[model samples]
Target: MTKQITDDLAQALWETLLLHSTKGRLRYGDITAIACEFGLTTKAVTRVWKKGIRSMGDRVAAVVKAGWSRRGRKKSLQSQTRPRTTEDLIEESVMLEIMKCGGSNTYKIPHQHKDKLRNAGKLPTTLPCDVQA
Candidate 1:
């Protein structure tokens, strides 16, 4: 995997490239000059510059600029604000009932039930009894 670039450096290079392009179209030589001025190799600068330009073109620069600071905050807030659906509630209740039915202690049950379930094709693809209790 490629190493990540710092936001400050990326932003600076993005602005620099944009300025260059606005005044006159940027070329490989311009990129090389900027890389030299920034004490970075041409390839490294090109990688960052291209990434920044792509991010800008796709209109995701602002979100990337913000990093993961607001990562799960909006999701949590939205979840708290919205009411759970009836289906969600029912599914949760069913899950709770399954948990209370000694689902985790299946090893205590006789092997006959497992064999019957397997024979009748009622068991899931993977047998729960094969897993830890």
Candidate 2:
């Protein structure tokens, strides 16, 4: 006569069978061996195998359906937003500062423009003397 198994025991047995099948490529004989080791019958092991296979198939089918739905959906508007480039604004600011110091060749103004600007901390000390204007 077949013994009644608890739900928890059945679940544990099912997981063990799945793990063994994955690792060793189990057959019905292997399932029977595992069932015997776990104090279960071959018929019980067969039931667990069937349940595990069905559950795995259902999970795979659900995932594939989800992927198909996502493939058919349109992307949100937020995903189309593009960030503005700061390159143009930065270049313009630098050009304006250079023009404020007069033409680029005004480094010939001796120490008046370059050294004064450096001493007042307005210009970087590393500014090349040739480009100071």
Candidate 3:
């Protein structure tokens, strides 16, 4: 499993690499020494070193760009705001009571429900649970 280092640790790692690197390239011995100092695997230290300066810069840039999103509830799409389930599609509360009698309502709701929902541009696959209707 990959280790999850905090931002501070990541920055410190980047700075340590910068100090040890010559022309953004770290020699094998330097990598091993840095890894031992940070208690990280030599492979992990070498992988970051191989990504060159851009990857190192990203570690610092992440701090500068942090908290811009201000974590909160994600915005809901208009069509997705309400449930699209068959039960939820039948908006009229009385429809549930009527549907409970049998497969579909006796007179108007069962007959017209699907057609009304269809013409109103609802998904045909999302028609009410009364398949017999």
Candidate 4:
């Protein structure tokens, strides 16, 4: 069974991250140390750290999917990050269909402007990333 990241733990982690943030960002070294202090993987802690920063940058609430899934035989970082709902899947499909019709559009998906995507209904209002690039 995969360990679940409870709201309380996530909240605590967020607060801890906030305290350690320098100009709204923490160094990766700091992230590793925080993870050690919290008895969590560095990736997990970093996931939370980046998300909080991104949310603030976007002027929205900080949110992330911070738990693992049980279906997978092995627990990998990718699986830990992608926890999707039916509605999310539907939205993604719609977005792909729209993108297919986007003639000569070659924007990198990850780096694309989210507001434009959201305005075009290609992405959801709230985007929770596992890691901030």
Candidate 5:
């Protein structure tokens, strides 16, 4: 009568089978030899081979389904860097205009003059006096 293969024997033989299969040199005789060496039935050896094949198939299927490895933390909004917007550009130009105006008290400049500077891309959104620099 044939003996049942132990877990350790199955694992060892499965690893050996993987090595041989990768080399394209696996055969039924190889399994039979392993079974004989480990005192297991040929059926037991084949069962382990089937289990290994199934495990590999499951892994391949999972990766194929996801299209990539879905591991680790996802990207955060804080980590994302967006391109400068039109509003940001306008604000920067306004600040540059204020600096170019001799750094004098912005409150002293008339609203119409400030508006002209703003149209010329030389005014900040708010005067330095209006808000703390």
Candidate 6:
């Protein structure tokens, strides 16, 4: 697996590359040299530069430019949050009951009961019981 670059190191590398590219477009040899210094592959350095820097066509770019989106799902507003469905509540209560009695085994919750639970979305998959019980 490739080693993950730390945010600080990446930022520093981006800044240094930006400084060098201010004169002219950075060459592959420059990226290779930086890669050697940082113990990263040249491809890794190029990828980082491409991701962090904007407009590869530009001869000069700033490393610390803003506007890159923060990734992942946006937070749902409190009003937009969904309430639990009836099936969800039932599944939760059943799981609590399972934990209370014993996991998947004790109190001998029947296969038919489990099947009913699965139908109601209380269980997602079959358990490892040898018999119906």
Q: How much does each candidate deviate from the true structure in C-alpha RMSD?
A: 12.4, 17.9, 8.6, 19.9, 16.3, 10.4
Q: Candidate 3, residues 1-133: lDDT per residue as tens digits? A: 3454554665677678888778766776887788888888877766555544654567744231222255688887998665545554455434654666654556345444655665597645433455542
For each candidate in turn, the TM-score is 0.39, 0.39, 0.44, 0.44, 0.38, 0.42
For residues 1-133, what per-residue lDDT tens digits would candidate 5 score against the true structure? Answer: 5654555556677777776675434675888887777777877767777777776767742111211235577776954754334465455555655666666646232333555665587755443443434
* Candidate 2 segments whose C-alpha is farther than 4 A from its true place: 23-25, 60-133
> Each candidate: what lDDT?
0.57, 0.58, 0.60, 0.66, 0.59, 0.63
lDDT of candidate 1 at residue 111, scale 0 to 100: 31
lDDT of 3 at 76: 79
Query: Which candidate should be chosen as best, given lDDT against the real structure?
Result: 4
Candidate 1 lDDT, 1-133, residue by residue in tens: 2334567766776677777875435865888888777777777677766666667678774322424344564545655553433344344444554565656543332233544654576744332331222
By descending lDDT, how would the candidates be arranged?
Answer: 4, 6, 3, 5, 2, 1
By TM-score, is 3 or 5 better? 3
Please list the residue runs of candidate 6 whose C-alpha ends up more than 4 Å from where it truly belongs after superposition. Answer: 51-80, 88-133
Candidate 3 clashing pairs?
none
Candidate 6 residue pairs in backbone clash: none
TM-score-wise, the better of 4 and 6 is 4
- Over 1-133, each residue of candidate 6 has an lDDT whose tens digit, in order, gives 2466777677788877877785547865899888888888888788777865555456455453322345567878999764444454455555655766657645433234544664676754333432322
**Residue-pair clashes per candidate, as listed?**
0, 0, 0, 0, 4, 0
**Candidate 5: which pairs clash?**
94-123, 94-124, 95-124, 97-122
Instruction: Estimate, for each residue in 3-115, the C-alpha lDDT of model 2 and write its tens digit.
Output: 66666677677667766775535854788678778787887767766766776767742111111234556776986754343344444445555665785744332233544
Error of 1 at 17 (Å): 1.2
